[model samples]
Target: MKNKEFIFLMILAAFLSATESYALDIEFSGSRHTVIKDKPEASTGLNDVFTIYDIKEVSFISIGNIIAPSDFRVLIYSNLGGGYAIEQPVSITGTTAFIHNPKGDMGYIVEDGDNRYCFWVVDYAGKHFDISSIEAYPEQDCDMTKITVIGSGDQIRYYSVSGRQCTLSRNIELSYNTLEWDNENNSYSLVEKTAGFEYLQTPLTLRPPFYCNTTVTVSGDRFLKTWGLGKTLESSIIEANGIDVNTEAVQTNLAPDDASNMIKSDGTMLGGSAPADFTFYAYVTDAVLHNEWQIADDPEFEYVRYRFNERDLTYTFDQEGKFYVRFIGSNADGSCEATGETYEIGIGASDLRIPNVFSPDGDGVNDTWKVGYRSLVEFKCWIFDRNGHQLFYFDRPELGWDGKHHGKTVSPGVYYYVIEAKGADGKKYKKGGDINILRYRKIGNSSGASGE
Candidate 1:
């Protein structure tokens, strides 16, 4: 009744006509005893009351843009157990005011106090049903957009952050379907409405660096210039605008004087050991960007990352191998790259010891004539007789001679041996000396024969 019009659908009208005998109606109230007649019912306060004047049951209630069953959930509550208790669920027809209640039907007084009952409208499915007035359900939270309207007519406008214009009159119930423009505030606002949550706008494109101008300077400040049309001194001045500068990555170049050394686990330089750490030194140069140095284990540069100190241009290698490293740098403006040449480092070459003697009588004690070297790059060993005839030859250090040539055990003698080995430092080492092969243990000796 509150100066608002109620537009009922055709189905609602027909249904109301059939149930006119019940005189079903909703009532509203104010603090000063002012009653609104036939208005869309809204709860004014905790004490506000609503009544289903003379209805036996309710199927649903229509409020704002929601038509019940199709858009929201409705529940009826009875004042019981010192508080309001939910009584039953109500189904709705998208077009009617109230239909037949399938659950426990109640033909009783509905109010806001102990003597009456109450109802709830729920947006259980996230349909974003906008309840126009807080007075409709003062105790329940309802979806609504709060807005302030100012000005009149062409000067009126709706105001909100990034708002739009308003078009509706003052003090009217608003819904998601309503769009009003306000001219005075120069912004748009939803009087008491909601359209769910808004999504973020698309991002703007990023612009690349641009070169404003490029001036080529000459050695002399004032250059002597000759012109046909006009005589003038040409200065080093080239002016332009909107010229994009393409950035490139710096090239990696390593110095030839770079050094690498193997160290023991105790941090001492490696002399003769297997598990030794290695350190690589990158000579500081203009083209080298210490912070951008990247070291890899394999030739393909797909190796494990090692800890490096850019201030010293050094990296420690815990494993043994040839590692590849390079320097890559880029300007802050992203307009140029400086890459250094790739440098290879060899490590784990401190231990290359060849035994001076071995008793190869197969007693498992110095049974094989071999060299002990960690990460040996390449190796070849040869044993010769007094006349320089090659008695035994071996290529792999792991596969050494057993003091035998073609299954024939050689007699115990002082044999001359030559070893050619490639160290992890990429350097070839040749060692020739006399190896005394003493037959300390015979094949079946009861007491192992001992000899010098």
Candidate 2:
């Protein structure tokens, strides 16, 4: 182990890295290049392995801080795959012995041999666990106290461009519930005070003379101010700091546009088509989030999700049986990864859809008549007096009932219902209901009384 540690030191001295290692445990070969480990299903490479016997360095992926009793993810370049930056994230447990490489490219890991090895320790407190041995990156040397911009067409989406930071109160809480900090379901956000980044929207096209430079500024957080994009694209820019970020999402246009049109369908700006009104659909996608990249874009399990890339749908099953549901689309770069929505399914739902709520009260809330299908091409609902005499018809969900017949409130009694609808499936499903309206009211000259 001592010999292995010596080798790691030598390689780190050679790399002369510029990044700060935060939570990851790193190691290197004799050349100072990184060693890579990866887990594909996740965006942050949480499952990558860092070899200890080999020995090297640990460098923060960038400039940041790592806290003990919390889960940290690291990214390392691979010396094995010909200089490729592979992920070698280390989930620290014990007060593991690791340090930054000379170049800051990695965390010089303990070589496994005589007395050193990089491994974590675990413990079960009252209810949770604790993980420690964390390090923070160095602060940027540049002052950058000021912010400026030089262009338009400024657009920032996803977790990309925010200026909000966590504010700690005078009384700080130091209790570490390892499970709360290390659980995949647990996320900790620290909003720090930062400045010097902005997002500005210049005219879609350079108004007069066209220049290639464009800029966005993001300010207000210290942690983000130092995240240099490597190359400057435009002088006019927007910037922000102290905001939450999924740094692992380095790829471009990889997530679905939550508000854009459904992919390949009507209202879509990219793929799919805009079908004429009334189309039925049912689709399902995973709700699991591999990493923090698209954390804010995940679907609501009890609601629906709409996307802007590819909208392909087929009827799927739900607890309510097979129903028409729709998944607008998936992101061009993301594979329903940390991007989705919640849902329910039903038959003939693509047409004027009516929820299961029916008003049987003489008082109005859902009273009078119901045409629950709001977006229907053609819809009709009929109410009868049990003798089969048609008394009401409705076509819109918003159309309410006053519980009256010929300007007189109908008496509390049993009623019959029939519905006709033209749904997205083109095929019609005629359904009927035998309802009982049990609402009662005061009977007198302006009498005021009611019950259900």
Candidate 3:
């Protein structure tokens, strides 16, 4: 029983393999222009059709390896009037049939048993189209432009700058083999191809309703070789210049010992000690005839403090208050004006305080000795041991010193700190205090001495 089942399975496998291997080999003969074997775009509904470019008025097609020679029939159809089949004579020799003098842009169907093979023949001997020039015409309306393509072709395709297809109009349609007849089902069905792959008639001219930065491409049948050269036209509509105001608050004057004051603020809103110097810069997309920088006390600019007509400005904020700054740019006619981003500048009064106690344990609570500061522009801090040996030093008020020297934790005892600073409000700071580091010693652990 097992041997018989195995034998039956082998026979079935052979039958299936033989069925899958059966294919009709179709060949074209005679002097032809060219043959484009590349598969058509899936949207063309001609996935199974092979394009044949013929220069001569006539061409021959040979269909060989027919499963049944008597059952093979070669049928030709026109692309017009819903595709009507033309009566063409076929000469048969052995298992092959010869099709004589097929027409251009016509569909050919070869029927053998329940299988049907289809293809398209494009005549390339007489088709002629070329792109002369492309021009752009601006309209009276803003951002409205008319683009004209001076060329001729059977169809035209539009593309973007990045080579993406753009839809022109959906109502336009070109005739091609979009449907195939099913012999076994005895009915006509739509071809298994993606939709919206149709091309438009050439000599195209259209004005886009809106304005954008894009690239336009015009081409005929992309799959054909004899089709004329494709031309790309770039159209850019110029508009008013865009303006942006970039600001930076920099401290130019530094104390002789405060060399680490390298932090600069470059944002719309900034808060620091008074007497800050800020440089304003204007970035414009196009040329501007007039550029002005304005500083006001209120956001609405009800009372303007200062106004400067320049491309860039360096202003000093000596008073303690919130100020609003903006930049304006305009064209020669002044009809087109653009305002840049508004900057909010805040100047605070200066004050500084130092902490007396801090725990440097791993609990993350006050792990470092840091000073309580408000707008101290120029600062210098030093941490020293009882032996007068400096352990850490910093020139910025925001920086702190952990209770470690040379990568080792110092002894939990009172340390000393000295600070010399100057505020933006012209105040001076000269202070010194003791910093105590309190740590709980673990069992059987000895307190390590301070590192040098």
Candidate 4:
């Protein structure tokens, strides 16, 4: 299979350089002209060469300094032994002439058979005239179903005749065939034919090229069905004159800087519950024409939790750390992703410590033991008594307990407390410790005795 493909490519290259065997001549009445050299005026000017692959809808020719109907009459010669003049109307802008097939005609397709035809622009009165460049465009109803490339490689993708990426699918019967060559007999024979593959029953409009060792398959259907119906598919081999596919437009190239530190509100290393804000920065190159930007933390990008403008290129990290950001930029062809640098946030316990002891004797000194929190984005504390009773609960570290239970003072005892907090780096922390309640003894003396 590989050898055959190599041979096919070589043949294609040779054919591309081969000159057309047929030619069209324009005769003059007074001053006869034999051959029209490729001069800028007569033979040189057309934006592109006329071919069925590049031209789907209509063909436009720009001939400079063309004299109205009286100067030249256009004719086409077909090896079918027939010569005919084009009756189509020619529109002109300045000195450039525009030619089109007559109304209700399917434009023009250069015949591929031995009886091929050549187009000629000549002076109607046998006067000399110059021909410039010619260009072709897809007509409203051009047929391309007869040509196709069957492969399963990445290069196989759907594109409009105008060279824009497209999506389309059509029901097509695919068949695989191979040729067998006999060494002694020096003859070639068909070896096998398999057309029952369900995967090939319906060929996707966007088919990739097949790798080596893959079977050669052909589409049974003539044309591909596009957005609606009757849309045609063109071959992609450059030498074959297919639309010029722009590969870079579908490429993905984007990156985000690595190794970001989780910081406190003061831009210092986040410790405990500091409420700091940090930004993640990424960039998409100007050369990449991507239509979608994807940002996620999961390696597979299961979901995207945040988004930032392409120009801004920033993602604010509010409280979570050890983030694995993935940035993907893509178009219709495929997608590429960049795994950004990981950021780890460590909030030191010293910044958010809880006092082990406090007294609430109503004397205004050490009335409550509040959980110490520095730069905390979120804080929660739960206090439980020795018997497993939840004595107090608060989300703010500043909102501490007053040593009261059900509106009554509880007996002095040791209590257990749990603390949970989120720092500015977007990290969660949990710690628990024991707390002691101390009360001064009240001296009961009837005789004006002051309590010590």
Index of the highest-TM-score prediction: 3
Q: Residue-wise lDDT of candidate 1 within 32-68, one digit each (tens)?
A: 2222122222221111222222222333343222223
Model 2 lowest lDDT segment of ten: 170-179
Residue ranges of candidate 3 with Cα displaced over 4 Å: 1-32, 41-45, 48-56, 76-88, 124-127, 140-147, 154-271, 280-452
Q: Using TM-score as the measure, what is the rank order of every candidate, best first?
A: 3, 1, 4, 2
Tens-digit lDDT track for model 4 on 233-339? Answer: 22322111111111111101111111111222234222223333334333332222343233455545576655543422433334443333433433223332223
The CA lDDT at 84 in model 3 is 38
TM-score of 1: 0.31
TM-score of each: 0.31, 0.23, 0.45, 0.24
Supply the global lDDT for candidate 4. 0.37
C-alpha lDDT score of every prediction, in listed order: 0.36, 0.30, 0.55, 0.37
Backbone clash pairs for candidate 3 read none
RMSD to the hidden true structure, all candidates: 24.9, 22.8, 17.3, 22.2
For each predicted model, how many residue pairs clash, with residues at least 3 apart or on different chains? 45, 79, 0, 32
State the lDDT at 304 in candidate 4: 63
